[model samples]
Target: MDLSTPPPDLYGRPRADTFFRFLTAFGDRYSPALGGPLLRRNPRRPFSRPTEALQLVVTARRRVAADVVELTLADPSGGPLPGWQPGAHLRLTLPSGRERHYSLCGDPADPADQADPAGSAERSGYRIAVRRLPDGGGGSAEIHDTLHPGTRLTARRPRNGFAFCAEPAVLFLAGGIGITPLLPMVREARRNGLDWHLVHTGRSADTLPFAAELRALDPARVHLRTDDEHGGPPTGTELLAHAPRGAAVYCCGPAPMLTAVQRALDASPAASLHFERFGAAPVTDGEPFTVRLGADGPELPVPADRSALDVLREARPDLPYSCKQGFCGTCEVRLLAGAPDHRDRRLTPERRADGALLPCVSRAAAGETLVLDL
Candidate 1:
């Protein structure tokens, strides 16, 4: 660990000192926090034991696009599954015990869409789409190659990090499988009779998932752009050229696409952007620190370029974590000692004050030791 000087001034990672201040200013500008709709009237449908483990059976599976497979998970006894809204994701534990989080693409209102071909009206399932990532960790590959009908998997209830909010106009930009979370959001926006548009882009039409469904919803409002058809990839500015002024923009895609969209937002301040990345944000401006597990447990050193979760896992490999990005609360632990340089978007001010921190993307200041409830 380097103790030579202070940390780098990375614009990407939020600094602990200014995070709460930024949050208040951001809420004032955005009108509502990114958690969800501020004007929702209907109560969330009843759900039992949201955080408990559920054994779900795969009732149906099919290829929706070139590398994407849509899987329908249902209760074995045909009971109602937990209710969720747009932007919610499921924590799936694969047969090999590797955990992965996938956005809930299917409509929560119609949980068992076509799962019961026999025309049963039971709201017995949830749907998710997975794009096989050969270069990524093995979760996607396992789902693509090994999982099939009748396969049972362990999963946690839905959790929403990239929630859709109420607005007069909405603009959605999706890249490849990043469309999963936005799918339900688009549906909700349209159902509410709100003005909305979608710009779906991918390598080609063959690689874009749910193209037919999108067009079937509204042909004129959906713009499907492909790199092959458009000569090459488009600039972030080009993507927003046709967006409505003062629209709420929701985006999910490759990091380059997101970075481009963020850059475009800088030039076009009329639109407010809310985005969810496919993977963890790259750590930047991090300073090395120490973490002492529990009271007398080992003190582990977290390098400047790495996360505390990554280092702690070496000592406790079974340490639970779903999304390494810190959006999900799976890796959160009690902050027993030291001031944390909080970087996660999941924790609220109340939770932080209650002594909780997500180690996945957060750390301690230089020369300080963060004692966690391992």
Candidate 2:
């Protein structure tokens, strides 16, 4: 670790210190400070927990567009789910029995949404933006076709996989549905009076929600790029035009957009680029191996052809999983001893280097005797 400066987080990873301060306010309660009767040991990790389940009751639902559904979920058990920071997401049991993970797009500090009775429930509830997927028989479709107001579901408590940094300003890039998780981070940055810019893209303006909000922000701070604008094509070049140096660029769109951003960021340092994905991916460089679960101590065969999730389920059916695509950290395991070859898209390289493994896509790189947390 470089001693030239203070280390970021415990991972020696770079982090915007203020982000941690903000996270401390969210469901991250500890004794002697946010004094409560509840005894605690885990001390409420923001982006650090494997998973925390919540009972979510859909209080409101609105069709923001043809494919997009905006939903408000509150306490199904009438209690606070957990503390969450911006860029947090929850995986849950949707109305169709299909599990899906949706980013929490609400302000973490908004007391109106807080689960505390003394705190406000008006703005404290979690908001999820779900767009109907053409092939997603699991998440998007269930939220679109089956869910409505009064629908109750079980969800993993909010966990922030994507975190903001303290860089001078931020450049947020959103593609298609990738815009959901980014909304809160943008709002927080703007509210904090941070100097940041946003480059939003979609098929057309009509397909993009928050057009009015984006425009309301100073024109210098926001730019909209639509592929099918009436004036002409949105000019794919416009997407690259806003690439600013020294500014952290976050992209959340389709694979094409992500690829474009990846290539664009190649021109800059790796730390300035961040992106999110909601698709299938192979565990790169994986080889067939065996995993030893801590509880049962059973030897399960994991093949190069099989996903770690698939092998684990066959060995331990009761294992928790949501958004098997790796967005939710429910299946995250602690690497008691092993060189984990991480392939998930959720964690930063520094954190992944710290020995956490998401069984959904990550696998063992060393020998056998992989000890798991659950």
Question: In model 1, where is the ten-residue run with the lowest total lDDT?
Answer: 5-14
- lDDT of every model, 2 decimals: 0.82, 0.68
Give the per-residue lDDT digits (tens) of candidate 1, residues 26-82.
554456435775522213333335357878999999999998999999988877666
Q: Candidate 2's C-alpha lDDT?
A: 0.68
Q: What is the lDDT of residue 291 in candidate 1?
A: 96
Q: Write the per-residue lDDT of candidate 2 for residues 1-374, one digit (tens) a residue.
A: 12233324322134556677676554344435446574333355435554455678888987765588889888865666555666777777766555667887767666666656465423347888888878544467667777788888887655555766535567888876677888877877777777678888788877786667666866788887777764643333456556555677777777666766666565553346776776655455667877877746877778876777778877777666676676556677777666666767678676676767888887765455566765
TM-score of each: 0.74, 0.65
Best by lDDT: 1
Q: Compare the candidates by TM-score and give the number of the best one.
A: 1
Segments of candidate 1 deviating more than 4 angstroms: 1-51, 110-122, 290-303, 311-320, 332-339, 345-357, 369-374
